[model samples]
Target: MSETIYERLGGEDAIAAVVDRFYERLLEDDRVAHFFEDVDMRRQRAHQTQFLSSVAGGPVEYSGEDMQSAHDHLDITPSDFDVIATHLAETLVEFEVEEADRAAVMEAVAGYEDDVVTVAAD
Candidate 1:
């Protein structure tokens, strides 16, 4: 795979397609439904595409808020992040994304756990 994350992820259209399936699975997966029940999927999808695109070494720039600040109030547990990651991997496999690229995507997100998930108050 090329060093560019965009080429690894099949570029904008492919990333968009993967994000679509990922959200579809999330909606149907009861375990993750609560996290997204109040979310506006359309906007979320756009944000995810931009986020992933930028994270994956693409040309697109993502100027969104810091991950920790964005997710700090969600009280997202590690397990929740695991479920999301697993489903995302499945979505990528379903779309026939290359294994190397899949690994790259996973590796990229794996490093962001501290920023993406925070323990909710008791």
Candidate 2:
């Protein structure tokens, strides 16, 4: 059997490191920084780490709010989502994640777009 993405990603410790670097990139980007202005980054990082761990098929279960509810108030644009995705891809590259694994991760993340990106009410 093939190794799960979590195992391929080097498990929890590596996921945590990736989350840290990913957040750093997000915070540095003007396009997405505003979304995190009032967020408690420590908690945010924890949630993200757990979330990704689950997505990567780790044993962790994410207990955070559902993606739609969690992001509903953020008024996130598709462009914002794209920027965030780019940061994630870049972070994975920085961590030297293999192209196939990175593609898998990005594909998994893309699956959440409908739930994460909220459109303004007309």
lDDT of 1 by residue, 1-122 (tens): 54686876788888999899999998899988888878888999998999889878888998878888888878888898999999988998998878987898889889898798797432
Off by over 4 Å in 2: 120-122
What TM-score, over all chains together, does every model reach? 0.91, 0.95
- Can you list the residue pairs that collide in candidate 2? none
Which candidate number maximizes lDDT? 2
Weakest 10 consecutive residues, lDDT, candidate 1? 113-122
- RMSD (Cα, Å) of candidate 2? 1.8
What TM-score does candidate 2 reach? Answer: 0.95
lDDT of 2 by residue, 3-78 (tens): 9999999999999999999999999998789999999999999999999999999999999999999999999988
RMSD for all candidates, in order, please: 2.2, 1.8
CA lDDT, every model vs. true structure: 0.86, 0.94
Candidate with maximal TM-score: 2
